[model samples]
Target: MGAAEWMQARSPEQSLTARIVRWYSFLSATLVGG
Candidate 1:
């Protein structure tokens, strides 16, 4: 899927709190891995 469509699809799958937690964890892992 395209970036815009993927983001649109994901937005409603989780609450704001859940999304934030997921994004934070992803960023942390990326930084650590890099």
Candidate 2:
């Protein structure tokens, strides 16, 4: 149960990190292209 709760809490953080990474990559590509 504790492990499940920890995993649930971690999943959002991982998702947010992935989103931030994707956004950063997009911005970098746009800047480089322009």
Q: Pick the candidate with the highest TM-score.
A: 1
Please provide, for model 1 over 1-34, each residue's C-alpha lDDT reduced to its tens digit, 9 standing for 90 to 100: 4644554467766656566777688889999999
Off by over 4 Å in 1: 1-14
Q: Residue pairs in steric clash, candidate 2? A: none
For residues 1-34, write the lDDT of model 2, one tens digit per residue. 5744554476766766666676688889999999
Query: What TM-score fits each model?
Result: 0.58, 0.54
**Ten contiguous residues minimizing lDDT sum, candidate 2:** 1-10
Error of 2 at 6 (Å): 24
